[model samples]
Target chain A: MNLRKLFAGAAVAAVALPVIAVSAPAGELTIPSLVYRTGPYAPNGIPFANGYADYWNLLNERDGGIEGSKINLIECETAYNTQQGVECYESTKGEGAGALVYQPLSTGITYQLIPKASADKIPVFSMGYGRTSAANGKVFEWIFNFPATYWDGATAIVQYIGDREGGMDKLKGKKLALVYHNSAYGKEPIRTLEVMAEKYGYELMLLPVDHPGQEQKATWLQVRRERPDWVMMWGWGVMNQVAIKEAASIRYPMDRFIGVWWSASENDVLPAGAGADGYLAAAVHAPGADFPVHADILKHLYDKNKGAGERDRVGEVLYNRGLAAAMWTSEAIRTAMKMHNTKDPTAAQVRDGFENLKVSEARLKELGLEGFTYGIEISCANHSGPGRAAIQQWDAKAKKWSIVSKFYDRMPEITGPLIEADSSAYAKENNITARSCN
Target chain B: MGGEFLFFIETTISGLMAGVMYALVALGFVLIFKASGIFNFAQGVLALFAGLTLVGLMEKFGLPPWAAIIATVGVMIVLAWLIERLVLQYLVNQDPIILFMSTIGLAYVLEGLGDIMWGSDVKVLEIGIPQGAVDWLLDDYGLYIEKLEIVAAVTGAIMVTGLAVFFNKTRIGRALRAVADDHQAALSVGISLRTIWVIVWSVSGIVALVAGVMWGSKSGVQFSLSLIALKALPVLILGGFTSIPGAIVGGLIIGVGEKWAEIYIGSLVGGAIENWFAYVLALGFLLFRPQGLFGERIIERV
Candidate 1:
């Protein structure tokens, strides 16, 4: 309590002040993906998320850690809740993040974040399923729905059905019902389908399922009565499984059933077992653990006890999808870096990578997505790059996916005028000149 | 019309499942009301907290699901005793409205505590409850049901049956009834008022656990279970505070009745009639039977 004690106390107080004032470290590049891995929609959400994170982690561990700078993924699980998704977005936005390119797997979350992204200048690359109008990129400069929108998926669905029915000329008198989850995501494809229905002469039925995707008995009961020739599903999570099971219960032909990329996954089919086998679903990416990249992952990280999940799920459907999502997001980062030639490139640099990016078919096959992914390209005016997808089918006996349809390109009859009008609308709205393909 | 009819019936089944869930929550309210004559509005949040505890214990702490379930119920018992001692003990003779308000505050406290503990991720409850649909009568429409609902229904029934038998037959149950009837008399008759209050609340805690598990298992455990408890308030009105059998009957009627209304009448009003049906039914019941279906009738004496 005397002279020596006073000096010790003063020393302790002096040491505490600097420690309190010290700011957090800024070296790590944090990316927050608001993906729902658990919830009613988890079956559909988990795989893409796992794959996305897997690809990111793999690049970190395998590829000299993302341009030799370590990346820290601050995970905030939203369980597909809109408010939780926003909260996750807000909380992680301020942590010295190099670039904030959120992949909010839910369309509703995407809609909520669009304005925020513009204010923050953060990029929102919603690989698939966002506002089709946002594809213009002028009004939504910070938003990038690369690959294809649901509208494109819708055209592809109708187109695939047409090809199955002989050709586009044989589409008349064909009845295709659009059974969609009753949300922004589920409803995205309907307007496009409506437009295509007028040209194709196929009657379209729109069925809306309530949230959580559990109860669809009544929705399918109508399918039994009217008996549509083909059904396009826009569902997520439990809704995906319930839709398939109900379709089975109604004795609807499994081959005629088509789900969007989100609606098809191992979780969706495994719960209902082999009854949903042969159910066709649209794919924006390849599936399986047998891909060369996945094999490398297993041999390296997994074999060395550093894999993210069960080794058995290495090339599983959702796991691969999640890995693909992460791959594209990281590749975009790589693209941005290669363009700028700097490790500390900002969000603007990342956007430039998105705007002037290319991932061709040859490069994809070389990357061991071999026959899986269709090549993609991006430009300023058109953010939804390459715009190609092949249909994938679940072979229940094999317990794996097999590519069914060849790369079905977008018909200009469907995308042409819509693109023109959208371009004009975007040009007028943003008060900017539209970019031309010189 | 035929399709819409099936849709209505299907909605009715969902509504009933929802209603059965509501009744399980309402059971906690009925327990407190019958034992202490105080409406515990915190029942919903308490159920949520209990469910969160169970999930945390199982998923995070690595306990087996069955062990977690047992441990969670044990925690609820201790929580009930602590609440009776620390919170409700001082408010014994307070105005009923003030006591009710205390419960409302407790509800907020419980919800905040749950958020702090569990971090608000909606967890898919896997208590091994069945999720498939059941069909009777040519499997077309009428009574098709999800197996989860049936488990909830049976669980609620067992809870109600257990409570009824306990109160009507057991020594402690008689002591509880005596306390509810006349606290002064019960005190004079050598029943410990504190002990009796503790037992009733602990019993109510068990009820909360049961309801919490079934509801959480059905709708993915989250803080949203608190909102489900709000549905139980009107349920108390229809069942009468002093009645156990009344609580069960009232909950069933509300559940099945709302389903019917939403299905038949909802189609005419663009299909959200289920939201307001309970209140409308309450209004009609209030006009015809103001004391509730089995609630005690009051007479003007002044």
Candidate 2:
């Protein structure tokens, strides 16, 4: 009789284990942040990860959770490697409330995750950087690169140059050099730049620097020889700093030398000292910690000693970018709940919410991000919101970046056709039908 | 000369300066290989560690530059003694492959310890090294040369001369040469092989620190400073592993050869050929002369 009783208890325990493993905790939204706090890119990755974690913490602490459903933020270290990022996504995607959304923060990992996330019915918010073609929502139903994309950045750069060179007509016969990291991320904007070059009649000089670009003596020597009218950089990590320093070494005009968004940061310029003064970079949002959202973060997180990183580095450019990404993510979650009429919406419902998401100027002010960035509205037809960018100059003496130009409008005439062609090719390859907005 | 010919000359001069930097790193490797018969793969990380320590001492502890440098040197000496006592003592008489693998593990340990000590954020290593293009060079001959590179070249020359004098004239240098020839024979002669290993590693540590300071100043002190080891590898292969002069000659050849290839040959294949051009040159050289330009030729009987 005792043996039979024991066997019955064991059988019940065995049946409950798998059920417990599969089920998410009730009334909690789990958002897994794949971060890199180690490795070569840690200097840049740490602040971004910290800003992301702090924003979520601010939402949970100050607001008592978004609509009373507390957020369970889980951080997994990826070290900025794509393989590790995929593993992080696989391990954390099914935890607590089924992972409402994902922000891979890496283009290589985003490319790897686009199909997986689509099949899993999860929304991917690549924010500003990813496959620019994913902006066409007809094919990329689950992927969103709101605010801007790399191709948009390239167009904005060209537009800014056109404005500086007197006019689009004045761009003819001008030599522009591109010193880019040799990677998919660096190569993404080439075709768009080539198209713009053809239309504008500017000579494009392409220079590729291998990964972990510490040595640029040869590349800069070529830059010296060519004597291009303007130099543009598509660089990241140590590459940006080294390129800036090398340019400074060669007495390249700081004002004319521009960098894509990733290449422009306090981390990049601070190392180059006074030589980095007047360095220009394309920006998607205003820099510095003056926003009201920063105050709320300080009150809710840093004041309570729960801040994710150094308190002094709270409002720097990359930190603010991370905060902006988290804001969009949380707002999307709120939108999902409101549309579904349920506090605990699954990842698929959140994807639906993303497809119809809109954040206006009023909403931006309400969220304490007034004048921080432009409004974003993601829809079925458009995954990239507005695709506007501005130029910012690094003032090394002041140790800050200030907006030096108005937002350059996204050139849809050029980018639209490119996006359509690429997304159509991708759709055909994957056998995916383009979905209609209506 | 035509404008294009002048540009080629300017590129060659720049390439030669870059080669001198690579040779500085290779010099550290040659020192350890000569005395200890170990490749000392951690030489690059040792440079990084030294830079991190020097920067940490100055920034965190607020030591004066001179005091911080001296303290860093002391730290390297202690590290050398510790490595000898802890790692080399246990691994003595091991196969060359095993010793090489141990140094790789040591590299990782040093790298982690460096990050933990200095924090991972890139720090400006301003040791008062003058930077920017030399005005005189640019104006006189239309040749652009960085002041920092000229300083590095002068420093490298001084270091090489000092090393040559020490190795040829000192009694300790003789002892080190005896140990390099035969460990058992050195022990029989009561030269203390272990002491010679510690001294040799300490000297290598000093060389690494010098290379680190130069590189850390050129670029910020960061993790990538350790990658100079990869650059030094082809130098070691070209200049026989045991020859100091060979390292210098090999570095210049690889550097100038790669630059010329990237400029002239790289365009045919869409540029960026400097990355692999050096390794290919070294490989081609090895096919013809298995014993490098300066490496001691080895003969064996079955």
Candidate 3:
């Protein structure tokens, strides 16, 4: 063979070495983790994946596998690409006793998997992302985006801005620029913001940053010209860090600039150092490793040196978000097990469990996450529970984020009709009947 | 000044500075292509690896910033030498496409290696360069200008001047030029092809380091920094692959054009045109001046 052929062969071998197929043993409850561990978004994706894996490992190590069925967490690396996420989903869906649920951790991936998972009878817990209309479980039955959605985030951010300006009526004639990543994920909140703009009379300026947003000189220059009263971002991964840096470089007041939950993380703010101080973002959970679940994770995982990430990063914002996602999914599994009266409940039973899920404040306290997040209550019609979030400020000197506001419940007046309209449109296009919950 | 004119001035100045940043990465590509006739796809990854190494040294080994930077330069040189020996040496007389493919492979290997050596986490690379907006510009002229962008502009100027001097005023530089003209003839005339290749690659590596430091400081040192290579591709296309000065001028034109397009025209089209606007301008350049503004016209006889 030629030298070119030889080198090509070697390259193929190098690439194929690390890809070990995940096959679970029988009688185990498999959870397909569609993770992006090696990509542009790895900085944020790493902690979340670690947190997610650590939680499942904690369940396996401490609770003897979520009430006697060993948890089989099969992590498939997506590299944050939509096609790779679908490939991961297809490859891992039939691992062992079949996959119970999927937490794709990506809006693009979630959008793609919504119909696929629905048809396959597998449930997708997109957490705070995916299509905001997916919150209408009557149309999007198998997909669950609980706790909050992007539309909820937009309204909450607007509410916070209005409160800062004294009242909702004070927002009239004010300019608010939405610097968002130019994708389905980033554009998720635009409709809600536009409606809010119409209602409150704030002039909305939209600036879209493309994927892996490393260069933003043009976008920020526009921000300087527009000189908006407040700036809100719906960015993710490197876009968040770059946007924050650009905002700081233009002497934009960091306090007036806010980011979505996905944009708020140590990875996003720490790079800007002292300039990021007072930069705010919406949060659904408390940060830091002070929670009892973190202590248990420390004991059952990190203390034994079996943690998925660094021992110190147990309670980071994204890590906690991931841990919370895992906690709720596992709770749904337990609910399925109890309702079905079997340890090995099917994927359909898990869907039922998620539909009927209600994690009250008392249960949160019992789970050692009492103050970490608000109570969740899901129903057949409402996959999005509470849809509430609080604003958090970054203290760059201390290198930590602290919640600074009470959880603001989403405006049903705004999102209800929008969700109904969008989901109804989706149902009409797909020729599917919306399920009646009542 | 009228508010519209001030905004225009602000946009132009910012675009020039952003262009200078893109030119910094393009210079490395120009260097390797000038000497070897092979487009080095690994240049951006080289920048990323250098930044990763510099930050990794400071964090992992507790080295001071100066020491870590010096050590990173040393690492880049050694890496250049290794690339020369392992990859380039074996593919010496092969097709240029083969060489280009090798660099693509090299890019992935270095990216993965950087991730493995220093875990794939966003690292704040603080060598104490001034960041944030320049206060006097903002206060006096009411113009927003980044201190880091100013620093990048000066750094790009110094690098270009030094490289021009090095390429035009040295014996080794002449040897590189001779090799660029005709590798076989240069070898026959006692100009060592291997030594010239190694030298060109080392210079490119240092360029990568400087580009990495500037860009990494702006947006924390991460894997996405490697994607800045995409920004430079248009620069190379418009400016000519083999001219360093062409890179800067092309970068400025593309930058100002895109920024103006995005600001003026983008608003009408619902925005986000800056990403594709650069490539479109480069395509226009390709259609008009395929040889680029500064690139030498080939006079091949039939």
Candidate 4:
């Protein structure tokens, strides 16, 4: 009787093991998106979050997920606060297939998650923001800020100004002002700009605006008195709108005023009305919702009444940026699958894939974003891809932004050394051994 | 020397214009505190709600600008009545801190409701307020002044005069002042405390609407509209919480002082001193005058 009972218990256990395995499928990929859907920055955050979610949803509906492995996309709200962002990261990192990658969408949060992500063997994609020196993959293997860094942006803006001034030599004696937010994200470009100033013999004036910068009467008053040749801004949220309005109030030439990518959006331009007509900003992707991928999104998501945000805002600049980030994430997952010959890859495997990823022009066309953005390539030694950017001008009359310049080459001569120096310093401070990538 | 003097003058004029808007928000706090003896901390959220309602009514219902303004004003009055009935009435005779804390909770509720009603997009409040710099001023004095700011200054002056008249000349206003002075004595003389509280809240709501229009017209109507309350706190601290005239004088002092500090002293310290200059000035002033610039002095009897 005891022998019979033992055999029966073993048979029942075997049956239950298969059921549990089926319920928690091994071939599922989980991506955790730390979003700020409600906060002072919600106007900017909501569209980006919607776009990110929509792109993934389109993939699930159209292609049945990446390489036949269903994607489990989980969103956690951080309200644009760093502490909440870390909490969101910790809580959601253990869900489902266990967060293959994290996109914090905030520099402050990305800074906090850098060490934590390395320890957890999960890759972090700060995209266009965060610590600019994280471009040096030797010290920051788990972090990726591709397309461009703040230093790259600062150099590109200087190049654009040089082009307008006839040549790089003409930049000498030119006075340029930088109106930036008073935070780590805002101060990222100061050192780069200063280096450029010393090299080109131009004067760089720095103006720091307090957070949520609604009041800029004094700052612009200084602008009027000094009358810098060009005013470049690194503002976010309400700060961008107020600066533009104040710039207009001072009768400053709008064409000469350029803002960083964060300040270049319809929400920023609309507040200042027609006075923002000639305002220019740095952009990593083309603006508007005219891409073929947008049509797929509309048909699969909005048309079926499953859209995440306003249907009209589907192709806005920031929306397209979010879509671009989601595409990069999906491509990296595909690379992991191809590289490891596995239906589902671990977080560490995904990091390996991100290191070896390349999104060519042909791939973008196939993905229906042919002209939506420039091609991006990442590797073991370099994390910030190609570091190219374009200048976009807001057409106040049309209520949209248009790319105004061809892609400017990334100034690796200026940024490369800075990244090496900063990253090396960080490595020594933290007792981290720099990795050798062959 | 000429350029420096001209720049200083330009900064002062611009600072005064900005100060008027701060005073408008501070006046809302003074009105409620004087009549009800409750420091209504939700004044800034009230402005945000008022702006959101105006914009929402215009956009969602397709109402014309004037019609939207009227409808929004009606909504604010109804909101005041609801607050008096649902919140204030229940918590009567509570500690002032309790009342202040209740308003803070109300601010959160109103802020959440505003976002839900209007959607969380930054909206342009275009009631046809003039934008762009005044060309003549720019040509004559090389001074750039936003025309919209000039309109805001004039509007603020008119609103302050109207409020001053309403507070001093009307029978209900006189009774409201009586309640502010001594609630028990006013009640004994047949003045209704509930009626006075409701009236004061409604008046403050109107002041909030004016501020909303001015500020919403300046910047966009968004979450930052609620943050303007933080800006008004320094103004209140400088002017005294219960004085309307004090609110305006305090606002000018802070606005001008900070602008000057940012221009002259800011560069020495790497420029962005406007944020803390106002608070520092208020703190320094408070050390000298414990009752504020115009607050009623308290004499304790042991």
Candidate 5:
């Protein structure tokens, strides 16, 4: 209780607090993993989370971390809730020299973080999902949705349908129904699809299925009533399985029915049993763990009993998507390190690396990912890369997906104007000046 | 018949079938409510637990569908007994709201326990129930109805009949009704309220299993199976919380009304309104008939 003793204790405590609470030591890279491993979406979320974590761990184990610096992964569970996602971002953004980048797996979370992460100078990689107009990097300078956007997926689907009917001209007067989850994520493709419908002269029917879509009998019955020539789905979680089952039960030709990349996963198709055969979906990467990177992951992680998920699940669709996300982020990190000549690059340096990212086919081969996915090139002007994807068909009996067609090039003629219009409006509303890439 | 009329009939039939599924879940709620006057919020989680257990048994131990169902039934019965002993016994004379709040807690506990016991993954539940559309209906009448929906309807009818008989005729059932009527009086009359609670919960557990199977067959067993309870909430509100028969009738009305509204009126409003249409109809019924169609009106002295 003496004043001298209290002052001594206070001085000791003040010194200890900073020592204990200091963010990760120098030369360690901090990556925040906003994951949803429990909840209704956990079925889809768990595999992706595992794959993402395991890939980062693989780099640490195989190469002694990215350029021998080691990675500090701060995994905070979001449970797929936007509010929780923001909390996770706030809590972990300042850890380990600051978060180099954020890969928010949920579109809702991505939209919420776009401005927040941008203002914080932290790059957000939504990767295939999120605000599609973030592809216009001039407006969304810190957000990157490379490989493809929902708009690209929509156009690719329509292009595939056009090719199937022999030509784009054959799509005239055809009825295309979109059974989508009634959320921001699902509504992203509506404008793009509507524009494509007008261009191709097809009738676009919109059927929105509410959240946690379990009772879809009414929606499917309407499908039978209208008998649209093609049904395209933009669904996730339980909605995907239910839609596929209902579509199968109605004996809708599974081949004619296609789903966006989010809807195409083993978890989505296997639930419907044999009926999900011949189902088609858009894919940014090839399915299966036969790629060399998977072998390295198995040897370095699973073989050492350090794998994040069940070993058998490593090659699944969502797992591969997660691994791909990690791979791309790590490459950007490497690019940042090289650009700055430091193993520990800051968030701004990482954002610059993302802007100048280039993963050519030869580099993909060097990374043991040859044929796993197509090449990606990012620039200050074009953050969306090629926005290319191939069509994959689910073989129910074999219980696998195979690439059935070549990657479809982006329909710039359709998406370019739409992105400009949407991004410009976004810039105007938010009072954000478009950054000049040049 | 005209195409529009035929379509209407088809939609009505489909609605009724869909109602049967909702009623299946509501039946569990009614069973618990009829016995303990507690609306078991964990009923849907119980169904999800049952489905997860059945699939877990099949995948882990290499059991066939029949063996898995039998094993899952035992697990559910044990779970019901545990809930009665560990949870309900402590809150025997507590307010109904307290008991209801306890079940909400129990829902989270059971949900987390199910996840721990059998990992949270989408499981395919193929217990040999026929799926896809009925060919004869499609070929003969140009109507599309699922074989699985027919199976669900038939199973529901049998379950309702069996439950009705059990509640009206059996000695344990009379004891259950007495306990529900007056717990203290039934205890004074040598009726073991604890025993009745165990039996009622066990029976409800079985009903939950049946519902789990039907829904799991439809959409693959996952966490969303628990959210199907949301669909049953309006059904419980419309069909008195205490009446089994009301569950079926209320379910049919809500199902048909929602489907018809979605198809006929939803298009004009940009669709996806079926999720809320059932609740709106139930709200209207709440305004007109607070006691519901088949629910008993109690006379209490002030």
Candidate 6:
């Protein structure tokens, strides 16, 4: 019923947002996307890439593309396979490109593409799931995983759990179970959990659920018997719903289940409905259909028959994440173009564009993204431009997810040394010389 | 002694619920292996698809609970018929291994098809199966059980009993038995092979629907339903591919045994026991009785 209303509303007062076309008088600023829109993992990729394409299209229509230069985006479907990802990269990276920046979305692709991207003067933006050590801009100049790395999130989750247990001391001897997808994404957080276990004296149990996570009888039974005080989920798509239901079936306290941002959504919760009340997920963006951007999307793009989805669901968790990614990348391109002679620039020029990038608090306020993020500032030393995250809990009463804790401070002291060691190890393993900060 | 003992007892009962779910997927494996000599690697995927269908109908189409369930069952029956006519019919008399490979391919096809039909996102299935708990006993300590888990156990038992009766008494069941014994012999006796194959696949599809509902309700349906099917291989080995009762007993044992091992021995061995529990059990059982508990023993007379 609500879906119908949203669709109806969209069909009403929506004028299409003008797109910014790339002048492309000579060479084009090519942004290649290796997306998996039709696969097992499609649930996560479709919305993200759809939002990405929409953003690029909006730029083309609104501002004649970035820097008054039209942006040409070539999407090569890889179906989330690394080999296919490389194939896409190889095929798409050579077409009159300027400031080559790739967001592979898959960590494996990120790892495989990093060397080539760096060699080709392209920058890889791995928002959350790539090499944590790349947080050090000195070692990995071309790779950028902005905002929050998995390690950063792991620490943030640990801190939230500790606070809920009364204090850091309360975490002593507590059981923290990791119900994770058996993939690179899930494995990213375990090292941090192990570190936390040693420092906090909490018992950490690792449960690896195979991809898509719907059948977890053995794992959940362990949860029932072992009774892990808390379960931290690092699953995506259908896996999230499965873990939550399994937890509910065993009558495990829902409050104790903490899903990583990717694992929590309307998609995850709607299926479980009332059964999934009281669960928690770490969110980096505000979740609601009420944001102005959502409203604008409905009134402008969707209503005009130009949006990717029904107009009403504009500010959904995933839609917002998609919007955020598009907005951030576009803003970076805008900034890059602004710096490059205020005209068409090369991919190398975009590198100079992202090098000293700044999205101040004032700009965030102007953009209505103030509370969604603290501030995004990218520099040579810091690839995770913004270092902040917040916790949101599912409230059955409201039938909505609500934010509970403000952004908790991450311990840079602990993370810094780990970053150094990681960079060193990465350099050694990959057989690349460590680029010194000097 | 009392409090800790009560805790221990409560955990075990909870552990049994876990056993029931394992048995659910295992029953799916047994169904296919008994009638059709194929392992049906697509069992887990079938469950995932069925579960996705139920949740999709309710959330997307606004189908009422009873209607969605009836429709899902009807859909599964159709799916069974389709498999028999389309894939199985073509692959008749092929190597069993080749048949297994086809199902593996079928697994991929089902997975891709499910994603396209249902957009890529995990859905919450609140069919409202029971949530509270049924009170039971542990003397000083009360043992509580999830109403959902109870439903799963009872449903499984009922399904198994109905299957046993159907096989022993029904005409089609006799035809299935004759086909299982010797395909050519059954064909010569005038039993329609096409009809028998359709019946077998349809029955297997129905079993998938049951497993789908139980596992989907318990875990929330997703593509991961296929992973649960893989775990059933060991269960099938222990229960024997030809025995229904073996699937049941084997499921309970795998589910409960894995839980107990993970808890009691996890601490001793860095705490991961569920990973290899079923295989170890199957190995030990194979050494003593290779044909499995309920499987007929083959004796060669030279």
- Model 3: per-residue Cα lDDT at residue A349: 97
Best by lDDT: 5
Evaluate residue A138 in candidate 6 and report its C-alpha lDDT on the 0 to 100 scale.
Answer: 81
Q: For residues A104-175, could you state the per-residue lDDT of candidate 5 as single tens digits? A: 999999999999999999999999999999999999999999989999999999999999999999999999
> Tens digit of lDDT per residue, candidate 3, span B92-161?
9999999999999999999999999998899999999899988998999988888898999999999999
Kindly report which residue stretches of model 5 are placed more than 4 angstroms away from their true locations once superposed: A1-22
Give the DockQ-based CAPRI class for model 2.
Answer: medium
lDDT of candidate 6 over B1-302, digit per residue (tens) = 77567556655666676667777787777767777678888888888888888888998899997899888888888887787777888887888998899889888888887877876565666776765455343222355556777898888889888998888999999888988887888889999877887777777777787788877665556565667776777777787778888887777777667667766775576544565776898878888989887887878899
DockQ, 0 to 1 scale, candidate 2: 0.60
Q: Please give, for residues A1-438, the per-residue lDDT of candidate 6 as tens digits.
A: 999999887766353221123223454567887788855566667777776776676667655777667778778898787999999888777654343678888888988987888889887877766787788888787888877787788888899999889998999989999988887788888888888888889999898776556445557756765788899999887778767766776678888899888877766766666668989888777777665555555555666788766555556677677777767776777777778765666666666666667877678766556666667788878887665678888866666777788886666765767888888887788787766552
Better lDDT candidate (2, 4): 4
Better of 1 and 3 by lDDT: 3
lDDT of 2: 0.89
Sliding window of 10 residues with minimal summed lDDT for model 3 chain A:
A18-27
In order, the Cα lDDT scores of the candidates are: 0.74, 0.89, 0.92, 0.90, 0.93, 0.75
lDDT at B47 for candidate 3?
96
Query: What are the clashing pairs of model 1?
Result: A41-A237, A47-A318, A48-A322, A51-A322, A51-A323, A52-A322, A52-A323, A52-A326, A289-A315, A377-A386
Off by over 4 Å in 4: A1-24
lDDT of 1 by residue, A126-228 (tens): 7776767667765567788878888788888888999999998798998998887777788887777878989878898777665654444446655765689
Q: Predictions ranked by DockQ, top down?
A: 3, 5, 4, 2, 6, 1
Model 4 lDDT tens row, B11-108: 89888988888898999999999888788889999999999999999888999999999999899999999999989999878988999999999998
The digit string of per-residue lDDT tens for model 4 on A1-438 reads 999999999999998785455343678888888888776898899889998999998998889999998887888999899999999999888777688999999999999999999999999999999988889898998999998999999999999999989999999999999999999999999999999999999999999999888888899998899999999999999999999999988888999999999999899999998889999999999998888999999999999999889999999878888898899999999999999999889999999889999999999999998988888889888999989999999999988899999899898889888999999998998899999983
Q: What tens-digit string does per-residue lDDT give for candidate 2 at A97-155?
A: 68889999899999999999999999999988889999999999999998999999999
Q: In model 6, how large is the Cα lDDT of residue B18?
A: 64
What tier of docking accuracy does candidate 3 attain?
A: high
Chain A: TM-score in each model: 0.89, 0.95, 0.94, 0.94, 0.96, 0.89
Clash count list over all predictions? 10, 0, 0, 1, 0, 35
Indicate which candidate wins on DockQ. 3
Clashes in predicted model 2: 0
